[model samples]
Target: MQNPASANANVTVTVTATATVSDFAELPATASHGPLRIEYRWVNERAGDAPIAVFLHEGLGSIAMWRDWPQTLCERLGMRGLVYSRPGYGLSTPRPHAQKWPADFMTAQACDILPALLDALSIDRDERGRMWVIGHSDGGSIALLYAALHPEALAGAVAIAPHVFVEDISVESIAQTKQLYETTDLRSKLSRYHADVDSAFYGWNDIWLDPAFRQWSIAGEIASIRQPLLAVQGHDDNYGTMAQIDTIAARVPHAQLVKLDACGHSPHRDAPEALNEAIAAFVLKISAS
Candidate 1:
């Protein structure tokens, strides 16, 4: 892995003209189990009268990793955007070395951390009309879980490449990644965005590889998500298959599906314009309805 100093030295952040908000900011956070400071950013310049949209990054995502997409989307949709690094990712604190995350780490993120994050920012249905979630990869799963658990709190959600169930392909991809981190320069590359690259990687990688995780499915939870939703996936995505979005659509007939051609796991990175346009249109349509 790249040394911490080298990684820190290579860090660069960019905010685009399309972004409604820019610059790093702080939030007053109180963790459920510890006293670590949790910081967050908001893109609200164009939030005119629309509901707030929270952007949840992928398993390997960080606020910086998102570049300026959050701002762009927030501006395009005339909505507020919230972006933060979950514990152990990005500028957030590393996970406690002693304990392995529970099998339901995704569940805890949806049930616990998200709520706390909203509370820390003083956001809710009352203030933001109804909460809207835009999550990618792991964040997508958390979004689905949040919408499932708190349907009343959301207007709708957009899940980009979310995992609803475990597949051999997903596990195999993760296993390959584990190897890359160990044998290649992948860890060094990752260190640029992570305080503790192993903590961030293993926390996600280990749990997903656990035997018990094979049964980690959220397809059953879709029935409870009464809110409108948009599920987008790329055809070329190697990490997950169409089954992820298909299951949600099958369960919730009203759910909209968008399968992009030639795109990979990171739609925002691989096809930012298309992703942003689709997202902006979807959010507008749902909010107007």
Candidate 2:
């Protein structure tokens, strides 16, 4: 494998025109909850038989927030891409006001919702082989859980700013964001991306702020993941420290680590060029082997 820092430093990110949303699909609730109308888009659909890259958004993120990063990365790798909005975010089904998400919400998403959505769309891993997963923040945690739970169903995983365990800084940052959401126009701004901005915001915020949630940890659970893993985080990330991906590297012996300079919690937004290059190289390296 090439040195991550050098590989990222050597590559240039080409600006590409934004891709349009392809379509939306609904998957009937396979579990106890309501049905979900997931908004998604496909990129490079003609990349026949190439491994697909599934992009998972962050806590406050949506399909629109991802913009054209997935398409850009897929085009670089000559691979297909799938980008989608989880329930209660983007154009997906909104959460009921009375419904309080459990601490295991991320687990349910990775094990249940993702599989159901993939089945609904006929992206069978058994037939098409394992696909790559690129997830950010909460979605990054979900990706780790998914890979640990279904090791055979994944080719590799790239987790950007994933949280294996909650930290004081995380809670503090979340609290600040909550305050901003309540006091500022954060809700209105988020509304442009989500069908029910409150649902999306509170669903994630409440769970993270819950006192019982401090004990939440996936460090033990992710040790079984045998796939090629790339864990990236920014040095200036306020929401989480390097310990997040560092723990992942310690657990998953073969996991590669990339610490970005002059970047923050969201490396994709702060350092898109370097992130794009790193991910493209990692994915390509794994695919070739």
Which candidate achieves the best lDDT against the true structure? 2
Clashing pairs for predicted structure model 1, backbone only: 2-188
- Clash count (model 1, backbone only): 1
lDDT of 2 at 191: 76
| Per-residue lDDT of candidate 2, residues 76-140 (tens digit) | 98888888888888767888988878988888889888877787677775633568888999999
* Candidate 2 Cα errors over 4 Å, as ranges: 1-22
List all candidate RMSDs to the true structure. Answer: 6.2, 8.3
CA lDDT, every model vs. true structure: 0.77, 0.82
lDDT of 1 by residue, 1-289 (tens): 0000001122234323222222222333335445333435777745565678888889987777788888887888878788888877776667877767777788878887777667655574586447688899999988889899987788789999999999898999999999998999999887876667788888888888889989988888767888888999999998999988999899889888999988999999888888888887887887677
Each prediction's TM-score versus the true structure: 0.87, 0.90
Q: Which residue segments of model 1 deviate by more than 4 Å?
A: 1-32, 46-49
